[model samples]
Target: MMRVKHGSFNHVEVVEEMIFAINVGYKVNDLCTRCSTSQLSQSRRFPFLRPVRFLTDSRDVLWIMDTSEPQIDGPDPSPAVDHGLLAELESLRQSHQSLRSRSAEMEETLLLAQRQREDCVNEIANMSKIIESLCSERDRLASRVGELEELLKEKEDKFLSKFEEELIERESMRVEIEVYKKKFESVEEEMEERGGLLSRSMEAVQTVKDGLIKVIQNVDDDKIPETLGDENGGNGDLRLDSEFMPVFEQIMEVRKLVDLADSKVSEYKEMKGKEKRQLENSVVSLTEENRDISSLLRVALMEKEAVEKSLNKLKGNTEQKRVALLQFAERGLQRVGFGFMMGSGGSIEQPMVESYGASSTGSKSDGSECEEEVVSLASTVEKIMKNLRLEITQLRRCLDESRSDNERLESLTTKQAQQISENSLYIKELEERERLLAQNIEELLVDIKETETEVDRWREACELEVVAGKNEVEERDKVVTILQQELEKTKSALEISNGKLKLKADLAAAAMAAQATAEKSLQLADSRATGLRERIEELTRQLEEADSRERSGRRSIMRICWPWRAFIKVNAGNGAAPRFPNVRRMLPEMQSLLHSRV
Candidate 1:
């Protein structure tokens, strides 16, 4: 028998109650098993749920009821006990069904949440990849921009230095050109003075030749009379020889002076020809230098145009990249915002619906906070985009200014080339004039040689006549004296002309020295120009490589962004809020990624 406490019910009553509770527990267990079985069948029905079937199915409730026979040591069971047991069992079955239905609904919601969580995780991973790629692209672009800026700075510095050198060289060349012009003008003046002297000398030689011819004619006419009277005039011949000896000596001195003048004129002509050839060579060298300078200028212009084209390409690439980044940012923001809202709403509504009015206020507050954060993020993105646009505009203005400067440089170069061409043409004209003068001088030299030969023959004939014409000696003495005086004047004029020729030769030597120095300077300029051209070529190659790299980068970025753009478009078209699972778990990571970059 069982001893019961005073406050407690009798053992019989206790036993009945205990049995009822056990029966109800068994019924609940059965309902739970049924629910679990139904869930498992439903999970099996969907291929997608096969992996999660175990997770979605509710656990089987095992009611460890006392299966052994009850020890009936108290009283016999009553009819009331049976009725009460029946009624309680019915109520328990109804409650068990309700709980089973509720558990099934909860399981379904859990499955949905799990599916969303998986999708959100996948999307978040994709988002992370995209963010990483974008960050890498940003870093690459920033590095490229920095490199390009450095290159531009170096190129600008080099160009400025080259321009300054060119300016200095041009100034030197101009000064040298002016010097040459002054020298040429001086040469022209000297040439004119020499021409005047040559004309005077020719006139004096003509007068001397005429006087000699008249004296020779008088000797010829008196030759027969002198031969017949030679013996009778022997004493007169002796007296005439004494008086004519000085005249004969004077004639020989005049012949020597004429020969000296002829030799001096030949030397002067040779020196003049050499000077003319040197001048022509100098002119040729100068023309060549000018051509080289013009070619260098053209190369510089071509390099400038190439640089401008590269700059334009860089600008276009930068603009495209900016636009792509903006579009990506906007799409990412939209996706993140929509996902956050959907995730928060789903998470909140689940608790609200399940809790049956519990924590409703807290869920509403959480949703508002999420919306506010999203709006702030959007506004910040907008502000960033605005700043970027402003920067782009400023860059464009700078590019425009650079373009204008390039155009101005091109115009200046063109004008300089035109001036150089004109100078070359002027030099050619001067050469033509010099050639004509050289021809005239050669003709004068030939005529002088012929006059010298005729003078020599006349001197021989006059010597023979002097030997035979002793009787006419007194009459010829006056003519001889006059001819001697004229010969002395011719010798004096020849001496003056010889001194001028020597001075002209010295001037030519000085001019040759100046030309050599000019040639050396021009050679140095040519070397420098070659160095600059090589540097320009290297810079152009670098720019081309940079452009190719930029193009490849753009292609890669396009390949990466296109899929995401398409995805965003599809979601938008569907008008369905993008769902993000595990928002509370992923929010921190997404925020860090976005905030750090933005």
Candidate 2:
């Protein structure tokens, strides 16, 4: 910086190296127009202030101070550097803002996914309830089928037992019938022999009657004696007499035979009574057996039909349960699929199970339904198995894809955060530069105020010296007047006596020397007053410069406070001045204080 005088004004101003000072015979164009930095040594002129840099380094030209006229142009940049680093900083700020917005969007999406997952869980619970109901219904149906089958089997057993009993009874009755036929034949044979004997006896009696009739007819009173004598043929003779005796014996024998026949007939009548009772008992027993067999047959036929119908119903229920399982099993798949049902479109049914594979039938196609036995059913079994390999593979693939997408997104977010953190560090350095500038300005203000107070004190001292010089001049004038009066008296006396003239002249010389010394003192006082006034004016100009620096710093304070207000408010109250300290040292203290308060 160089000083120059222009009119009565004295103050500092800034000038560019590109411009020349025509009045001062100085060419600034020779100085480096493309300044390497935005700061210079203002300390060369102002010793009270610490050296400091410009507000920012984006400018390419130099900082120049001129005490001549204030320059029109502001801190202008060099043509060589172009737009500098400002454009790059702007682009980074925009990208950081976008990353923050994207992170917010991701949070919202995650919330929606959580809601959908909850809904799926509720749906799964309801499905489990449905499955439980179906299982209970199936169990009930199976029990019913089992009961019907048992009833049918019991009926069959009863029918078989009764039928066997009836068969034994029929065989006994057939043997009895054969015995009766043989008895009838024997009785007929006896009757035929008796009839033959009776016929023979009748023939003999007829011959004897004919002989007796002839004897009676021929033997009137005259023939009677001769007939008797001749009939005895020798009845009168001894041989005749023996013949009549033999006839009497034969008559006795016939009487004995008739008595024997009477006893035999009584024995036969008792035997016939006993045989008739036995025949009646056999017939009654057979009729009772038939009735029982018929009743059992009717009951068995009813049970058979009931069993068939129950089996048909059980079959239908099995089909329904299988279908319900299929519907409930297909749903949102989870990882690994072990916690839930997973199956393909071809779901298992009861018919495919090993235990249930064989179909049931109570009758042959050509046989009577009434003769059929009960169908068999077993209740304690599960009958369906689903295959799930295909479905699980599909779910696994989807989960893999989703996991990959999430990993990539996380990596992108971390990179963006790193960039924003780097930018924040640069901003911290800029803040530090601004704090130094404020401190330098304050020191300059303090120095200017001190100088102004000193100038005032010096001017007062000069005014006092001038007043003393004026008093001396007035006393000298009084002394000179007195000396002149005395000289005139001496001259008058010399006329009376010429010898006193030399003494009066000596008094006059001493008064003239005092007056010249007083005039020189007045001249010295005027020069000192002029010098004090000039110093006061210089102090005033320096103060004006300090005021301008303060005003510019005030403008920056409004804008810069935005980033630091929270920090300032927490560390110091709003009424106090904001301080910028090295964050590393301050952080520990702030943390300790906050912890103590908490």
Error of 1 at 46 (Å): 29
Given candidate 2, what's the lDDT at residue 156?
42
Candidate 1 lDDT tens digits, 286-384: 456446544544554454455446445544644664575456446534433345445565754553354334334433454354344334434534544
Give stretches of model 2 more than 4 Å off.
Answer: 1-86, 97-105, 108-112, 178-598
Instruction: Give the lowest summed-lDDT range of ten residues in model 2.
Output: 374-383
| Candidate that scores best on TM-score | 1
Candidate 1 TM-score to native:
0.28
Clashing pairs in 2: 13-66, 232-235, 234-237
Residues 169-286, candidate 2: write the lDDT tens digits. Answer: 6566446545644544554454554343333233223333333334333322123222222222322333324323443334334334433433443454445446445434533543
Residue 542 error, candidate 1, Å = 99
lDDT of each: 0.48, 0.39
